[model samples]
Target: MKKIVTLFAALTIITFLSACGGGEENADAEEKKTIRFGATSGPYSDMVTEAIAPLLEEKGYEVTNKEFTDYVQPNKALANGDLDANLFQHKIYLESFAEEHNLDLSEVIIVPTAPMGIYSSEYKDIESVETGSTMGIPNDPTNLARALIILEDEGLVTLKEDVDPLRASLNDIVENPKEIQFVEVEAGQLPRLVDSEDLSMVPGNYALAAEMDLLSALALEDMPDDYRNRVAVKTEDLDAQFAKDIKEVVESEEFEQIIDEKFEGFGKPQWMKEEE
Candidate 1:
């Protein structure tokens, strides 16, 4: 009986030690000053590289970013615990994707988004373009509406009454004074059509990828808030220290200076403009 009691006490002590060690590990993980950010290739990633990451590093964080080619993977990686935060999506997309995939996600901050713009190698301006011009537009549904909205705003086309701009389609055009012929292609490839088509509506990120100046566009979209891109993280981490830090860095004056210098013509979010 004495030997058995001693054996039981030894087992209890070992279990206690193991539990204490595990608690220490969890504490260490929580205390580690590291952040992993994911972004789509191009200006979004460059935003992190040029400003955000450096700012976090200054605050004693070991920051790392992963560039994704497609939109889907970044959210998936964040949900899977592979990424601490991601910055390539807007609140609408993040919400929609999270609902669709049954993943919990939330927006930390809305960044100044590059707006869709009208570019032309032929016409000098929107008014100078000829009638029946074969215009290049984004083939993807997500961006097609944006291109059409820009056209409407430029007084080139008029959508049917009550047409939701977000869901605007070619069939919704009630009047097109320009007699614009549409050519739909991949959004990312629209920049290449500047030399070939009468006018090409290029998404901003793609234009930056192809080295086109945003100001060079004949007109840039008056971007809606929902359309602006944002930094996202797991819903549970929405209030975490990392998310707060990201918000702080973005709201910094230095961040705006960098955006003005490097990412010219990006439409400022309402909050960002309020600061200006």
Candidate 2:
């Protein structure tokens, strides 16, 4: 009886050891196989849920998505290592924010982004904008410049000739032909400002989030490649496997099909339109 009991105890100990070893190996295999992707709670998040995550799953990755209501937290979370990746800001905003916050982040893949546009409730067309009308622009510097540039294109405002159009601010404006009084508003609030302000420059993502139609804009921006949003990760992770996977997924034909089917009117980047 004693000898039988000893044999059984030894067998139980061996099984427990083997199970522990297997668990460690399993954890090791999963180290970089799970992606923590973050984005603002809008079209970009939908893109991850509907387009990117599905493709990554097929390639044997487990993707976890987090949606933020604001622009600031997504990048901060990525820098803090709380997220493996994020998509929200364009190249200039991303670079500027990282520099200001002293965080090292980089753009991985540029996606089809919604172009910013001037929206209004009172004015039916750009030609009808009245003199001394109040206009709302984004308070953030990059977008403020972007908004001003679009105004310049429409011949409503003009910046100093030597200033980089992308970096132009209100002070750079040498001419306000319409005598427009531009009010700086938070970017997210511009959609609702349409009724309150004579002209509101709404970013594409915010306009879509507010269920505003892109085609109804008074005028759409001629967005540059620099102004288009991209998937961003830590600078150190730029060469990482998951970053490469994201780039591959974004550049895939299937992903492009998804964009065309759902994200209508979002102008494709120059690189995407190159082969056409």
Candidate 3:
């Protein structure tokens, strides 16, 4: 009886040790495989949580998504090793942010642009804005210039000779023959001012926040190749596989369907392949 009891105890001990070792191995395997991403609130980030992340998971990747509300934090987090990647900014914003913070950031993939739109509370169309009608645009340099270019493209004003996208401003308007009121307001405040002003050009993010429909705008931002939408990763971790996964996710048809569903014709994902 004593010998049988001793053999059973030994067997139980061996089984427990084997189980512990297996658990450690499984944990090691799981630790070896996870991709982290940071994103801001709203449609851009929503698209990731709803569509992109799941699609990547289907390909055997474990994904970690960090949701943030502010624009500045995600990039900072990526720089500080708090996040592995972010998907909320365009190339121009990323470059400006990196320059301001003196961080090395690299864009892994080009994503969609939430094109700027010109909306009005009073006027039905661009033609209705008569002489001396007031107009409001974002005061930020990049967006202000972008809005001006759209105004110029609509033949509502004329920019200075040889001024490209960067150099556009009220001073560039040489042919404001209509004497339209061009007011510069803070980007976030533009939507609020629309009710008081004749027309306003606000960022798409803010416009969406204000519950405004972008499809009703008189004119929209022209989509360009270098027009500022990209998925950013730390310069050191911008490995080929990371780039491949991001590109595949961004260009996938699943992403396109989400855009169409959520934006409801107000926004669209324009890609270079379609342009080509």
Candidate 4:
């Protein structure tokens, strides 16, 4: 009877040990499942660090945010396998960048966007600008086109009727009512020149980075659907589990709440506003 009792006790102990070991192994597997996301500094980096990363961690994902100061590096890192995903560019920009660099990248999901705005430290409003006044715009092709569109909308210029907005250039402008001299500057440098230029068209993200108020813009562009920022991943990894997880998190209520709290003037996510 004593031997049988001892045998039962040993078996129970072995079963408990095995259960604990299994739990440990499961945790180790989860820890090994890390996802590295890259974003430009400022709002993009803040969104991931403040909202997305914590939510992902709660789901047992080890999340890392690799921040870059410029737009070029994030996509480069993603294409080279240094990053699992990136969350810094709009669909048009992503398409342009991938095509230009011959990279196989695709948008995972469209995130919230910051509307581009025309700001002037010297002028009170768009109508106050004088003829021949210079306006600073982004030098990148896509953004320059966007700025020109905004100028057109404000009745400052007229682009050719058939010009593709995504690819439009200063040469595409057929009319300049005010004869505004367009100065193409680096996108990151536009905000600093806001006071110097008669007017400047700034992307919302860059304006925010410069600590400028979004509501203070003389005119804010009604961004086209394609202009919304997106999370991009290597085309081959589009079906991967981590990519799916990222899509889920970005579409969650928690993500929207963070956007509302942290980025009041920034545009809302299209999914949240879309009718169910």
Candidate 5:
């Protein structure tokens, strides 16, 4: 009886250690498998968190969305190993940013460009916008140029023929029918400033953040030459299975549906092909 009790006690000790070892192994395995996603706090991120994330979660991916307020950080995070992927910026912005920051990031999927628009609380319609009326626009280079293009498209202003589309601005405007006054504000603040300014050129996400419907936009951005919005990962990791998973999530039917439903036919941007 004494021998049996001693043997039982030894077995119990071994079993406890084995269970502890198994628990540790599981903890290590879980630690090895984490996917980090980065985006800004806008329609894109909100839609990802609300819509795209669930789809990825269902595929056994552990999705972590790291939200940023500025345009610079998301790509930076993805490039520096802080994030596995980022979905906030367009291909143009990503290309420019990667060049500027010297980061080796590659586009995985081209998402839709949120159609930027000019919104006004004062004017009933775009045609009603008076000459010499004050206009608010974002100070960012790409968006500012896009805003000027929208104005030109509406016959409100004319830009120099030689001015580049990504760099055009009021400086490029050759003739302003009303000598329209321009107020340069941060992209995020344009929507809020619209109440005070005669008109504001706001990005779709910011417009949505301000709770304005896209259908009410007086003018929407024309699809530019390139896909502006996209998902990006480190160039070296582009071929990794995790990177492929992100691309799959980006190109999935569920993501396309989210764009269709939430955007409501406002912005119809193109996607990068599967081969790209």
Candidate 6:
């Protein structure tokens, strides 16, 4: 009788231990369903915190957002798996960065972008700027080309017909009707230089960071459809379940409403509009 009772007690204890272990394993699996995303500080980070993260949480995802101050680090972090994804660059910038770094990154979805614009505190309009005046443009190749295109559109300058617009440079300019002396400044610094420089070409993100109004731009870039900002992930992770969920959430009606309400005139929802 003593042996029988001892054996039964052992069996009961083993079963209880097994059940507790199983519960712990299940909790670990649930915790594994998390996403770590990277983004530049300012509007990109704002969107994720204000809208994207909450929507993801509602869908049972544990989301982590890491903010970056510069452009280069985010992609580097994503490529090394420090970040599962990133949202801070346009398609051209991402392609250029990936090629230079030899990293395999891919765009998941294009988000609304604040179009680049030529801003001036010294002049009310592009036409009012006197000949031989100085204009500030971004020094980075991609944005330098973009700024040059804006100059071409404004008739202040022209570029060689054969040159790719994405690769255009100061040397590519075939004409400078205004004889506008171009000053190369960092893209982020262009906004602050607006008062000193007769005119400055500023990226939409930088403009917003400087608290400048999008509508205040003297001339806005008719941004190419491909130039819109995107959420990027490692090519290998492109089809991962979390990545697919992110793409869906970004393109959902809930995300669109948040953007429309928060972003307002910053930029239109290219993804939503395309779906229509």
**Highest TM-score against the true fold, candidate:** 1
| Model 1 ranges off by over 4 Å | 1-26, 29-32
Q: What is the per-residue lDDT of model 5 for residues 179-257, given as tens digits with 9 covering 90 to 100?
A: 7899998898999878998999988778888888887888878857363667788999889777777778767777777
Instruction: Estimate every model's Cα lDDT from 0 to 1.
Output: 0.91, 0.92, 0.79, 0.87, 0.80, 0.88
What is candidate 3's local distance difference test score? 0.79
Deviation from native of the Cα of residue 144 in model 4, angstroms: 1.2
Error of 2 at 113 (Å): 1.6
Q: Which candidate, 1 or 5, has the higher TM-score?
A: 1
lDDT per residue as tens, model 4, 198-245 = 889899998998899998999988787698888899999899877888
Give TM-scores for every candidate, taking all chains together and pairing residue i with residue i. Answer: 0.90, 0.83, 0.83, 0.81, 0.79, 0.83
lDDT by residue for model 2 (143-237), tens:
89889889999999878989987788899989888999988989989998999999899999889989999989999988999999899999999
Flag regions of model 2 displaced more than 4 Å: 1-27
Misplaced by over 4 Å in model 3 are: 1-29, 265-276
By lDDT: ranked, best first: 2, 1, 6, 4, 5, 3
Candidate 5's C-alpha lDDT?
Answer: 0.80
Per-prediction RMSD in angstroms? 3.5, 5.1, 6.0, 5.5, 6.6, 4.2
Using lDDT as the yardstick, the better of models 1 and 3 is 1
Cα displacement (angstroms), candidate 1, residue 55, comes to 1.1
For model 1, where is the 10-residue window of minimal lDDT? 25-34
